[model samples]
Target chain A: MINTEPSRTRLPAVLATAKNSDGARDEPGEEIPQTISPIRTFLMGRSSGAGVDLLFYGVMVLCAVSIFVIVLAIIFVLFQNSALSRHQFGFTFFKGQDWDPVSGLFGAWPFIVGTLLSSLIALVIAVPLALGVAIFVTELCPKFLQGPISFLTELLAAIPSVVYGLWGIFVLVPLVRDHVGPFLLKYLGWTGLFGGLNIGVGLLTAGIILAIMILPVISSLTRDVMRAVPTSQREAVLALGATRWEMIRTGVLRNARIGIVGSIILGLGRALGETMAVTMLIGNRAEVPHSLFSPAHTLASVIANEFSEATGDLYLSSLIEIGLALFAVTIVVNAIARLLIWAVTRGAPARVA
Target chain B: MAIEPAGVSLPDNTPGPVPASEPKSTGPGRNRNVLRSVIDHSVTGLSILATVVVLAPLVAILGYLLFKGFSSLNFAFFTQAPRPVGEAGGGMANAIVGSGIVLAIASAIGIPVGIGAGVYLAEYGRNGVFANFVRFTADVLNGVPSIVMGIAAYSLIVVRQHHFSAMAGGIALAIMMVPTITRTTEEMLATVPGAVREAALGLGIPKWRTTISVALRTASPGIITGCMLAFSRVAGETAPLLFTAFGNQFWSVKLGQPIAALPLQIYIYAVSPYDEWHRLAWAGALVLIVLIMASVTLVRIFAGRGVLKGNS
Candidate 1:
């Protein structure tokens, strides 16, 4: 796997130089203290070599454990800061819909609903497209076309959310308003979901942008999972005189279902957590509506829109509470996604055997 | 098994043959085959259409930004603070500089700890409880909404310090960077051969020396690329900086002071009602997109060269 990069050679030399500098700190006369070949004891007892080893281990352990520490700290800090609202509203804070800053009233219901609906909409739109892309890449695409297409798909993920926001504002919104929204409403206007005013910046718009943003994530991840399905599995199915489509369905998609689900959940996590683009387009309204065209605010968008100007202690705490809720939702979703993917891959050999 | 021979059971859609079970019913059989082929080809065509639909936005965003944003990207745009509303000319120089400084601070704090954590995971963890816990927590942390991280930093650093500061913004970005860098570093280290470690140990090298010198050396390129990706990610983040850095109007380097950043600046400009501000926002978007796209391309090159493993 090692490809020779000229730069790789310089890294060890730099490390050696650093080690020499470290060695310079130890005088020759101090060698008497180190002559015992200090490599035997673990942590409590220390020889010189053991001391260095212990130091390294200690640092590594601390760093490793720091991840847990940071997560706990996030939970703790968010909960602690949101205490004011928790005390003020009790269980009603989440259920109440009003979010007036002037009256000093805040409720998370609309924002929570908005977040969920927008994310759900995004998932609905993105999943089929993502599946199609993934299938195309792993099963159908010609050999020469695969790499370029795959790269192009991933490039979608690399573009920042803010750029998406910019595009949503300048380009996508207008197209939706002028054409797509009218087209959908004309055919489906009897359905209240598509019947509402076409302001061009609302849950549907935000969701579509989110779908666009997350398509690459789902597609690429599913492609990875499907690629992991052994070639022998496909060959076996194909040898049955099954068509390419049927072979892919039975051999690849069936095997990678769990991983694909995980990929979808991962995309869901991203959609739920996406901020700048969603915030920019979701219209910053704090009220939930029946129609998809209504302007609404997600928990993240609310926090982004108001955290700076929120003056009252309760207002700030309420914003923090929304953040906490967003944090909790995304964490749970992502943890589940991670576990599923882990189970599929780490458990793969046993399944194959 | 139904034990039907392939020629009898499997439909022969090819022109040369018809199944014996068909009993010379050529018209219906051919029609069925044609319908099936049509469905198959249509499905494939639809998928190709999906790929195109997905790719169209990227092309449009770049094209629109280039067409609209290029004119505003001038020497003055890069050298001066944003102009007052209604005025035509100002650059995000302060925001650019602020982004650099904040990212520098974030990398300074995050990279070492992330790499160290990765070392522990690869060398000593090996599916241990603590390692699993760390890894799981990192995944969760990576998925935490960036805005929530902003809240966390606001409480931890800003509230404690009684003000928004560049330090808080940097810490917020650092928190975001840690999980990415740690995970990538762990994966890269896992790619290093165990034989290398054994050889180093056989030569009487200390375990720590072997890991830091040999294993880490081999994994450095991937780890560096990961860190770069993390940097690019944080550089474009706005929500985290919204309540943390709090945006400055002028150039300032002090860590404790409120600082401007490119993403935050773009957000402000984009949201502003003025047409001039929108123009500047377009320019900022273009610059930010170019920066991120370049970093991503670099990552692809690195991964293609096998410097990175399983991280497309």
Candidate 2:
């Protein structure tokens, strides 16, 4: 079947060449008899060049639609394999706290809560910093410094997540446990959120590392959005005798607010699904955290940490279900994000800048 | 002093010219303006500080990894499997070779199909309903967590085969690569001038031939870089391989057999309780970082030269 796809497209080109050969036979001194069969020539005549191109075009459309097929396959496999948990636990599977694999009890509540809380914390920490970086790079920094600084910021995204995990283990965890955690506990101890034992590796550490991991994505994307704002807007605001900040506030940022929000949501999507660094730093505890310093396990982290050790069919299915939930969350979040971005730039010329 | 108009307040300071204020009369208002300016300047300063603070980790990770891991990266580290537990001085040869093999298989699966889909998007299905669906699916696929992909691969390949294998691992990696390569290839192909297509079509060339031979050739460099970036990304992904490749202690090259990879080895070593393994993990990390950085740098160099023409 695959071989025929190419040959079908090739036949038209061959027929065109054969027609050219016939045309050559019509010229003076060209006495060669056409070797082409009449039936074959008739068939070729019936299928115009446009029809052959249309055939290939249809083939290419199938190729494009196959990408959608792959995505559906991913969703299908995840849902199909997790059927045991879906049947056994039902709705309670999402809400139950018990997750013992030995006794066959499984609950996704803690993992779900942990994933949300960590991603929330990551966004809280990342959004302000990323906005600042974007603002500075777009509106404040000297032209000479802008390119290098933006490049440096984006370099963070290129570093593998495992390397981030390594750095978290060696550098960030200790810094959090020794200093930042204790300080937050000491000062914000009145609030229950910060009132916990300051283990270096916990929800906060994971969240902070997630923030750092996603900083480049948010900042770069925001910069792209902010840069997309027409310069005329900035100049108009400035012409009204506004300060640089005021011009940026009233012009560039306001114009790009939807896109900026989309970028932040996109960052949130990434944080929700980040695995290696969060797994390494979150201490791999399957409990709902009482406070920022308490250890927790996100869905992605839990799956990464325990997929290999899960021996039973139910155990494996439960993990697959967690993956399904994670897949569902990220898909929903990213879809919304893309739509928000599309609203701002729809029908605009698609260009990298 | 000149009497002010009744109920008139002072005009707010603006960069444009304003009526001159009596110094003695507007002293308090002047103080408020000064404070506002001070706050604004400091806010800018803080934003700059925030940029620096966020950027520090990239430098720290690179510098620290180079400092800590560079020492352990000798000849032996590249040519041997990880030492068993406590006794020191081994390498990650199997994992390195396994990574190469897995990535090779992944590229083989991902590149042609991804570029074909991209060609469809750019050439045939531009703005069509099915094209939009494919584009959206690619976006969602890119955002799908690697661990979830691992789970999907586990269900799809491992369960059917009744065991983990390199083929499953490659499929997971290929799945991860597909969206990125497809999107970037579409972007690259979109950058190819329309005139090129018209030129090819005016010659009575089939649209498929024009897309494949003419347009694809023009966009090939960017697409190559996109595939490279995708390869570099999956090369360091550990989560998808956790259940798929499943790791090996010694050498294994069969496609159906389980294998080890650099990221998987690094994950195992980093999490293991032994100090020597941690040291080896550091070395492996340095090597992995180098591999990723090399590709990224190559992309950047190509990007700077306008080879991708900013379509990346």
Highest DockQ, which number?
1
lDDT of 2 by residue, A53-154 (tens): 888777767767777888888889888889998999998999999888889999999999899999999999999999999988877776668889988988
Give the DockQ-based CAPRI class for model 1.
acceptable
Q: How much is A67 displaced in model 1, in angstroms?
A: 1.6
Specify the poorest-scoring 10-residue window by lDDT in model 2 chain A: A24-33
TM-score of candidate 1 to 2 decimals: 0.88
Q: Please provide, for model 1 over A191-276, each residue's C-alpha lDDT reduced to its tens digit, 9 standing for 90 to 100.
A: 77786678899888999999999999899889878866766676676666555666668888899999999999999999988999
* Per-model TM against the reference: 0.88, 0.87
Task: Give per-candidate clash totals.
Answer: 1, 0
List residue ranges in candidate 1 displaced over 4 A. A1-48, A347-353, B1-23, B27-31, B298-312
DockQ each = 0.42, 0.36
